[model samples]
Target: MIRFENVSVTYDGAYEPAVQDIDFTVPEGELTLLVGPSGTGKSTVLGAVSGLVPHFTGGTLRGRVTVAGRDTRTHKPRELADVVGTVGQDPLSHFVTDTVEDELAYGMESLGLAPDVMRRRVEETLDLLGLNELRDRPIATLSGGQQQRVAIGSVLTPHPKVLVLDEPTSALDPAAAEEVLAVLQRLVHDLGTTVLMAEHRLERVVHYADRVVLLPSSGARPVLGTPPEVMAVSPVYPPVVDLGRLAGWSPLPLTIRDARRSAGELRERLADIAPVNGRLPHGDTSPRKDPNPRPEVPAPRRFLRRRTTRTAPDTSTPHPAAAVTALAVHRDRVEALRHVELTVTPGETVALMGRNGAGKSTLLAALVGLVEPTRGSVRVGGAVPHRAAPRDLVQRVGLVPQEPRDLLYADTVAAECAAADRDAGAAEGSCRALVSELLPGVGDDTHPRDLSEGQRLALALAVVLTARPPLLLLDEPTRGLDYAAKARLVSILRALAAEGHAIVLATHDVELAAEIAHRVVVLADGEVVADGPTADVVVASPSFAPQVTKVLAPQRWLTVSQVREALSS
Candidate 1:
């Protein structure tokens, strides 16, 4: 059990306290969820519990904090190592070993556990994490998801009573994230270990949480309650929750299975009303009211979206593929993207999804000539990447990287847009208009990276669109976004596809793939394992399936909106 008695934390930096006069208690063996928008002190609370608050982080802590009845102020992280285990947003920051096996054993060795005990725990944890196959693999070779599991396994080997995770699944692909989450669930359900986790992707994990703690950013204090109690009152929720609100169902269903049943009842009761057509007319239910002094924690949402200017293209005609061919790439070692055949006509959105290090980034780089493949050829607009100068590719192919900081460093957003246009020989006036349309919040003089990650991605996208690139390659475009930001980003991507721009969105979000992508290409170990429509690809990989699939139309649905539609229909 972890208890905070009037605990407030203030950092040395200028400004207000990170956490103010907070009082809360997490009972032992309960799965508690800590949720709030970015910079909301969720991580601060975790640090307090882990003995890093005033110790490692050098923060001022008022009042008392105790774990399992032991005062935390007296115990530093190293001192409390036997009681609590913690993981952070980025795994690379905490890794202390060179290989997966060595990584797992490092923590136990710190505790001075006997060799036999350590070996048994190591073997058990590796098997439990489904990482036995990668036991000897170098930590650097593992995907983001795999590395995170190894991190978790390392901590669990010591058998701490409390586990704290800060967005453990944020960087992972949907399938691998689910695998890691399942282990966490098992730990809580089977072992009764206390789990406190803060995450942005609530839709993926909210349904499974035993308790919900919502922290409003305006220092409005937190509200702790059950999942349904919190979600029913949540100002911003996922599509299913949104449906429950708009449809006015009592005891709102957090899962689609329950939503489906309630929806059927509503349909029967409202049979006399205008026959339901999945989507209501121009206006459905009134928008949610946010007159409260503090806004409820809106669901983890996106930063922003970019747009391209041009009368939206009409994608009514599907272009026939000239032919499917193999693209070979050689980079020191042969990372074969075997017979990588893809079929995309104008107007199709194809999503490339896989765990980190699965070659999604490599594939994107290959198409643009940043990396040359020894075996296959990349033909864009019926020409090769090097076939044109960087300027020519700017006019024909657009690429947005995962880290928005990668290409943006200009003094102003307008300058960045103008630079891309000048290189592509596009009209400066046209570029400015396109940038404004794509990023409404940003001004001409705004620093590109100064905006949020979502905004930067949108800005980069706008700059690329300004070039009128026929083929657009976006790598993990939604990497650090929340629910609303991701929704808007996909909306923009969808609109672009509707306008006939050939788009390849490389992402780890299965929900996004289900919602926007016409097709999904699954890459594993640097090779395409499945390529087809979103529905087909989801069917082929059950773990990669989105939550909506398990909820409404267990087999056919991929996105939450689709699940809601099927339920009402």
Candidate 2:
């Protein structure tokens, strides 16, 4: 249904093509997954399928891209709307209506479909995506994950023959992601719909793909094969495949069930050697305690004083980096968070996890002073966040929000890094160094807006770390990052925590939590449903466990790194 013949794309800039000599064919009624590292033109390839590459994006296409026998070169996106539906990474940019129901119906209305048909399709999409309760909610009031579902449903309602998605499940929780993927599976199997998706979170979608197309690196030719064939040689793969490689299993397993079937002997090998706890090593930082400590301050003071004036190296009796007691926040008459209590000490990492709109992002907002608590108190670095002065707050805490572009205002990346250094009172090139470390090959002259989603996230993170705040907050830190980039990020964050910085990240990436988080705090319906050690919280819950933990069940293993450590010792 989709064919690319010697395709190459180059923007107006003076450089080589973004994608070079990309040729592939995706059969009708099959799901094709596009895999690659950041900035390898996965998005560009998807845009070509929808005719957005050279048409709306102001790029030059050298070859042919056809969808459903319609040449994209001749057919613009609007002309092909009847047969093609495209959903990009940023869902907020795709909406034209105010509410969920309206957004879903907007596409059909544009297509001039009958009102009755449109209504029926809209209801079906809402139920398929589990957006029934949110159908009346405003798009602005919904969470990031909810917005992603609405974006997908808007495209799905049109009943197009082809669906082109970019990071479709990046923002969704595990269960929601599975629901969306299952719906795509039904479309492929029952309705003969075609799907071409590009995603960074391979663990969630690799096994669901009918075929795999890999763009190994920038300007490299594409490699197409079955999932196992491609994953055997592909640079990026999920943890289950990684375990299969480590155990020397033939035909690397793509799913947990396959891995578990071959794990009987491996389980016995690890039975005597307990899996290493995936936490900060003891003696690396301060003495640890339960994350849910009793409240030390009774009232919220505008200018609360620091508990101790000693430096970061002074770990004896160190105060909490951030404290929340009976915290509550209400937005648009909805209780976003209610009576949430938590504490984070210096040199600690915590992950806030839950379903879409379950108060994880809201809690992070309260910590960084973006949202005022309806009740209770929030203290970060010994000062009330909402009332603290801007200058003081910069030194106390820094937040990398869900939308990375929100933190970038400069025209070029170089200018943004310079501005961050000056604002943070840091030496020149500090931000640039962090950027290079996190995401290599990002040029100084490039526009921040032109960077890929993962690249933008890295720039935002570097800007925040330039200030060296005692407390750091990240929302969906690994949204666009591949395994290599995520590993660099884990190394950086671990080093920061060792230097006495407290980290709290709100994310749905269970593999990431399993890798770096010392604690996992699960939220539900604006309340704290569960909070405990990473291994304890994720392993016990079927919804949040990583691939390795699920494969090696009855054993408390959480990550491939832990298993590798145990095997090496």
Candidate 3:
């Protein structure tokens, strides 16, 4: 249904083409996954299919892209809207209506569909994506993941033959991601719909793809094959594939079930050894021990203990870097958070995890003073976050919000780093150095807006880390990061923890939490549901467990690094 013939795209900038000689054919009713590292022109390819590459993005297209018998070059996006539905990386930029129901119906209205047909499709999409409860909520008031669902539903309501999605599940929790993927699966299988999706989180969608298109790097020719064939030599792959490679499996596994089936012998080999609790440096052969040890208390009991003991103070106990006691936050008459309790000490790494609207971001907002608590207290470095002075707060805490662009407001990358250094009172080159370490190829002269989502996230993280605040909070830190970039981030955050910085990151990437988080704190419906050691909490939960944990279950291995360490020893 989709064909790219000798395709190449180059923007107005004086540099190499974003993509070159990209030729591929996606059969009708099949799901094709575009996989690559950051800045590899995956988004550009998607744009070309939707007739947005040169038409709207001001780029030069060298070859033809045909979708559903119509050439994209001849038909603009609006003209092709009847057969094609495209959802870009940022969902907030895609909405044209105020409420969820209206957003879902907007596309059909544009298509001039009958009102009754539009209403029926809208209701079906709402139920399919589990957005029925949020149908009346304002698009602006919904969480990032919720907005993403609304964006997807909007496109879906039109019942297009072809769907182009960029990072469709990046903002969703595991269950919600599964729901979205399942919806796509139903479309491809039952309805004969064609899908071309580009995503960084391969762990979530690799198994669902009917075929895989691997883009090695920027301006490189593409490699197309089956999921296993592409993953065999692909630079980027999920943990299960990595684990299969480490254990010398015949064919790399894409799903947890396949990995588990092939892990019988490997499990026997690792049966005598216990996995490490946290990440270990490469080539480190030291004895595996829990880096951040905790008492053997159950999660529920531990939460209750902390709640009951909050009223009494121990003078000898060192002050926590940040603490939230019975915190509650209300937004638009909806309780975003309620009775939430959390504490972070120096050198501790805590991961806040939950569903799409589960109050994780709200709690982070409370910590960084972005949201005022409706009830209870939020103290950072011995001062209430909402009441702390700006200068004092800068030194005490820093936040990298979910939307990385919100923290960036400079014309160039160098200027943004310089501004960050100045605002943090740090050395002139400190922020730039952090950026170089996190994202090496990013040019100093490049505008922050020109960078890819992963690059922008790296820049934002560098800006925050320049301050060297005692406490750091990150929301969805790995949203746009590939495995290599995520590894670099994990190493940097580990160094910061070693330097006595407390870190709290809200994320849906369970693999990231397994790699760096010393403890995992789960929230649901604006309250803490589980709080305990990383292994204990993640292993027990079905929705939040990483691929490694699920594959090596009955054993408490949380990451491939830990499994590698155990096998080596």
Candidate 4:
């Protein structure tokens, strides 16, 4: 259904072609996954299929690209709208209407479908994507995940033969991502639709793909094969594959079930060693002690001693300098947050997690002065965030928002870093140095707009970190990052935390939360439903557990490194 023959794309001022000599064929009714490291032209390939490469993006395409037998070279995106459906990374940019129902119908209206057919398709899409509860809600009010589903539903309503998606589940929680993937599976199996998707979170979608397209670094020729065949050499891969690699499994397992079937001996080996939790460094071989450590004496003796001794100086006391009390925020009569209270001492890392529309973003915004609290108070570093001046706020708190584009405005990477250094009164190249540390391959001369989603996020984070604020706020910081990039970020955040920076991140990436966060706070319906140590919260919630934890069940393992460490020890 989709074919590319020696296709190459080069932007106007690019030093090299974004994608060079890529030849691949995606059969009808098959799901093809496009994957590579950051800035390796996954998005560029998707654009080529929809004719967006040269038609709208102003890039030069060098070979033949066809969708459903129609050459994209001769036909513009609009000309092939009936046969191809494309959804990009940014969902908000795709919406042309205010309400969910209207947004879903806008594409069909543009296609000039018969009213009866359009109506039936719209309803079917609404049911298929579980958007019935939000049919009349304003698109602006929906969370990022909801917006993503709407963006996909809008395209699916057109009943196109080929669907091209970029990072479709980046913003969704695990359950919601599964729902979206299930819909895609149905389209491929039941309706004979073709799916071509590029995603960074391979753990969620790799097992569902019928075939895999691997793009090597530096515009190298693409490789195509089955999931295990391609994943063996892919630089970025899911945790199951990582586990398979660590265990020397003959054929890598892409899903937890397969991994589990071969993990009986591995599980028995790790049963004796405790699971490592946080930023455990290399050469640190000591087994992680239990969070609630007990004395060597018997339980009754320890309980009697503790009962006699004044309950050992409550370790849970909040930092007097930075604490929130009765915080509440209301937007458009909907309570984004209500009666919430949180506190962070210096050098603490907190992860805020929940389903979409669960007030995670609202809480992060309140910390950085983006959204004002409706009632109660929020204090960070002894000052109210909403009332602080720009210069004062920069030193107290810095937020890397979900959309990194919101923080970037300069033309080139050098200029953006320079502006950040100027704004924060840092050394001349401090921001640039941090950018290099976070994203080494991105050149200073490259335009910020030309960077990949992961690179853009790294740039934005570097810009924010230049100030070295006492409190750091990040919302979904790992949306598009590969495992390697995420590891770099984890090290960076761990270093910052050690340097007395308080970090708060609101994210749907469970593996990330498992790896870095010292505390996990789960919010639901504008209220704090669960708040505790990371292990307690995530281990109890099945949807929020990491892949390794799922495979090593009833144990508190969180990452592949932890499992590897236990076996090595």
Candidate 5:
């Protein structure tokens, strides 16, 4: 369906080419996964096929990129529309229409199809993507999963032979992501549409991928092979894959279930050896909880509540938390939330999970009236969000948007945090101390923009956390952050939860969600479909649950802590 022959992409800026001497092929009717760390130009590959690299983004391109035998250089996005469908990481930024049906019909209409032809295709797509019930719903009012499906539906209507997705599941909760993946799987199997996708959450799609390709961060060449082969060689990998690498398991397990099925021998041997806790006993991880000095031989941290030592809580009524009831309202056309009921209690961390365009961000924005709901109410810490003064909201609610850069504008890291402190009516001088404590080496002299994405994320997190708000909301804090950075963010959030603060995190990254959230909430089409303690919510729905949770389902382990608990039991 597509081919890249000795393709090298050089941007207009004075830097080296993003991709150098890359040669690859996407076989017709096959599903190919492009995996890599941030800035590896996985998206750039997609852009080349969609004609976005040279046609839209300024760049000097060498070699050839052809889609369905048509060279992209000779065809623009519009010309390739009939042969290709592309979806990016951020769904909100890609929308063109205001309602669900209209949004899905956009591409068909643009192609100047007959009215009857457009109507039939629209109806088929709505049902195909499970968006029928949301057909009349406003595009902005739909959840992240709903919106992303609409985005896919819009493109699929063109009957394109190829579909290119750039982290399509990056923002979705496990369940919604599963739904989207299931739809794509069906498309590839039933309709024979070839798929070329770039994604960060590999575990979710790894099992289904026909082939996995790893892009080198050094811009040298792309590594191509089977899932296990590619993952074994890539420095950037999921924990289980890393475990498989270390265990010397021949024909390494691709899924946790695969690991579990063959883990009896390892488990029997390791059980006699003693529990491996705290951090993976023998892996690449710094001391997350303990600082100053690292431990050589680490045992997994003991679960505070051991399954064998405790009894299940009374299953009569749900525990009511002291969380906010959010009313989501955004821009003029987008009403992401409508009188939605949600809450967070003291000593609890609630994970917000859904697809890219789901109301998660809008819900986070609504919690503090950033984008106030047009009709309903939002209450934080017993008071309505709109009722609180701007300064009061700053003191009570701290938000870290998906792109941390949005929250940072100061020339220096210290100054950015100082601004946050100023909003809290606290001493500006304390910002430097707080930021330095959270992010070592951060100072008033380091330009915030010049720092790496991980550093910038940490800086933004420090700025928000300095306020020490009673209610904190974070939107995709894991984006662009390395594993260590992810661990640090998780540790700080855990500490805050222990200190009697309520936290809500919106993320598509499952392993991080598994590590942090005390409770998990699954959102679909702007409705609360599942809610409970971390284990219950994540395990209750297999399709929507994270792969880690799914693999240990019925055994019921949500995190490493729980895994330890299960072993002890």
Candidate 6:
């Protein structure tokens, strides 16, 4: 359905082409996954499919890109709207209307479909994406995952033959991501729709792809093959694929079920091996007690505890780094969080995880003073965060929000880095150096708005880390990051934690929690449902468990590296 023939895209003012001589064909009625590391032109390739690369993006397209036999070179995006539906990385930019129902129908109205057809498609899309309850809700008020589903529903209502999606599941939780992928599967199988998608969360979509297109590097040729054929040598892959490689499994299992089937012997080999930090195997799933002998703080007055943990007392008392006592936050009559008691000391890494709309983001915002608690107090470095001045907040805490664009404003990446250094009063080029280490190969002259979702996130993270605040907060930090970039972030955050930086990250990336989180805090309906050590929390919660944990369950392994180490020893 979509074809790229000797295509190369060179953006204006770019030192080299974004991509070179990319030749591939996404067969009709199939889901094709385009994957590569950060800044490797995956987005550029997706843009070519929808005629946005050289047309709207102000780049030069040298060769041919045809979707449904219509040449993108000759037809602009609007002209191909009936045949192609493109969803960019940022969902906020994709919406033209405010309400969920209106956004879904907007595309059909633009296509001039009959009233009956538009109405029918709108209802069908709402049901298909499981957005029935949210049809009347405002788009801006929805959570990141809900907004993502709405963005996709808007395009699917148009009934285009080809769908080009960039990071469709980055903001979605695992279950929600599965729902979206299942919708795509139905579209391809039931209706023969063609899909060309670029995503960094390969673990969620790699198993469902009909074929894989890999762009290994900038200006490099593409590799096209079956999922395993490409994943065996691909640098970016899911943890399960890594496990298959570690065990030398043939044909490289793509799904967890396949990996589990082949892991019986390996499981037996590591049956006696213990998980890190004394996490029991398939037994004793309760919250682990605090290891320190410090006294526990009582819940604040007038607060009813829904769930509570015994937070370790501040050994270096008189001033705890960060603390939330009986915190309650209400938004639009909805209790986003209630009676939450939490504390973070110097050199601690805490991960907040839960389902969609679980108040994870709200909690992170409260820490950085973006959201004020309706009751109780939130103190960071001995100052109330919501009342602290912006300049003062920057010194005590820094928050990298879910939307990376919020923190980026400069036209060029270099300018943004320079501004970060200036704002944080850091040494010149410090932010630039961090960005280089986090995301290599991205040109300094490139616009931050033009970067892929993961690259933009790296830039935002670098901006936040420039200040080196005593406490740091990240909301969905690994939303669009591939495994390698995620590893780099894990290393950086681990170093920061070791350097006495208290870190709190609200995330849905279970594998990431397994990597760097010293403790896991699960939130539900604005309440802390579970808080414990990482191994105990994740191993008990099957839905939140990492792939290696699932495959080797009953044994309490949390990551592929853990299993690899146990085997090697």
Question: What's the TM-score of every candidate structure?
Answer: 0.76, 0.94, 0.93, 0.92, 0.76, 0.90
Pitting candidate 1 against candidate 4, the one with the higher lDDT is 4
Best by lDDT: 2
In the order shown, the candidates' Cα RMSDs to the true structure are 7.6, 5.7, 6.6, 7.6, 8.3, 7.4
Error of 3 at 28 (Å): 0.7
lDDT of 3 at 412: 97
lDDT of 6 by residue, 369-471 (tens): 9888899899998899889988878878999999999999999989999999889877888788778777777778989977767788889988987777878
In candidate 4, what are the lDDT values of residues 276-393, reduced to their tens digit?
A: 4444221223754445111111112221222221112122334432577899999886889999999876666789999988999998889888889899999987899899998888
Tens digit of per-residue lDDT, candidate 1, span 357-429:
6777777877776877567667666657756688766756688886666777789987887787787676666
Q: What C-alpha lDDT values do all the predictions have?
A: 0.71, 0.87, 0.86, 0.84, 0.70, 0.83
Better by lDDT, candidate 6 or 2 = 2
lDDT per residue (tens digit) for residues 379-487 in model 2: 9978998998877788789999999999999999999999999888778887887777666788898899988777898899889977878899999989888898887
Q: By lDDT, is 1 or 3 better?
A: 3
Lowest-lDDT window of 10 residues in candidate 3? Answer: 294-303
Cα lDDT tens digits for candidate 3, 498-564? 5467889999999988888878999999999999878789889999988988898887787787777
Q: What is residue 177's positional error in candidate 4, in angstroms?
A: 0.3
Judged by lDDT against the true structure, how good is candidate 3? Answer: 0.86
Off by over 4 Å in 6: 218-220, 276-319, 412-418, 425-433, 436-446
